[model samples]
Target: MTATPTPSRPVWRTALLGSVAFVALLWVLEVVDQTTGSALDAEVFANGITPRDTDGLVGILLAPLLHGGFGHLAGNTVPLLVLGFLLLLSGVPRALAVTAVVWLTAGAGVWLVGAPGVHLGASVLVFGWLAFLLVRGVFARNLGQVALGLVLLVVYGGVLWGVLPGDPGVSWEGHLFGALGGIGAAAVLARPR
Candidate 1:
């Protein structure tokens, strides 16, 4: 007798699950940080990225998982879920690769040129995903993706101003570099193999 094949899940389901899991992680980390009296930002973990400091390098991996407060995390949640779900629609492996590029680029840029203070938040990834979604269609010459990108631009274009040095408390460097990373990823990943 022939065995039945298990049906694969839809890409949308996978994307939704991945997006929710990622957002949940951010919330859980924030809760732990707050409950521990902000110990994550304190001497114990010191999880924020500090410019040009050797000890602060660990933040490149952990900083995106943290935030200043619940308010901060909330501000990032919607954008993250939206952009992350769209990105993951391309498949998890590709999305992960794009994310790695943006993550490293944003963290390193902050470490190299950020102001003299600890930087922590998911904004870097948000900006990265934003830029990635905005230009990836153009890079791939996919009309559907191009249309989606245009729609996203209409919705999130105002935030692009964040790449500049406007807010003293905002890490514009992270935004700029995350965007750059996204562009670079699109050029590399969306190219014809």
Candidate 2:
């Protein structure tokens, strides 16, 4: 018997599916943590980037995936969805590369200079995407992208306050560094005229 051929997927659809899958993964991890009485959180905290702690450096790679609780994750959900979807719409491979740059920059920045504590959450990535979306157009010299950036700025500008060291428990460093990483990514990835 001959097998039916699978249809090619559209780029937008693929990006949408990837974003949905990522959010689903985050929810699943949160559910597991909640169900296990936060046992998973312990692992997260243990692995979380602790400034000056050599061993905790590994958490740099894992921190974005671990959240303090569902409430924490909830705060990050919309931003992640919006920013991630926009990034992926540009192209999945490029988006992924941009994410990796932001991830490493945010994580390393936190590890190097963050306050003493376990820094965990996708907020880091969210902030990075925000920065990227806000500045990428200027570097690329694209009027459309510039317009998109302005719109994003008007909508999400308030969150920029996150970079300030205000909350005792919040990782403002991550926000600041994630933003820097985003700018960096845009600069590195911008199309030459």
**Backbone clash pairs in model 2 (N, Cα, C under 3 Å; residues 3+ apart or in different chains), count:** 0
User: How close is every model to the real structure, measured as TM-score?
Assistant: 0.96, 0.93
TM-score between model 1 and native: 0.96
RMSD of 1: 1.1
Candidate 1 residue lDDT tens string, 1-193: 9999999999999999999999998898789889999987775567689889998898888788889899989999999999999999999999999999999999999999988888889899989888998998888889999999999999998999999999888889988988898888898887655
Q: State which candidate has the highest lDDT.
A: 1
Instruction: Write candidate 2's Cα lDDT for 1-193 as tens digits.
Output: 9999999888788888888889889989889888988766676456567877997788898888888888999999988988888899889888998999999999999999999888889999999999998999989998888999999999999999999999888999999999999999999986655
The positional error of residue 51 in candidate 1, measured at the CA in angstroms, is 0.3
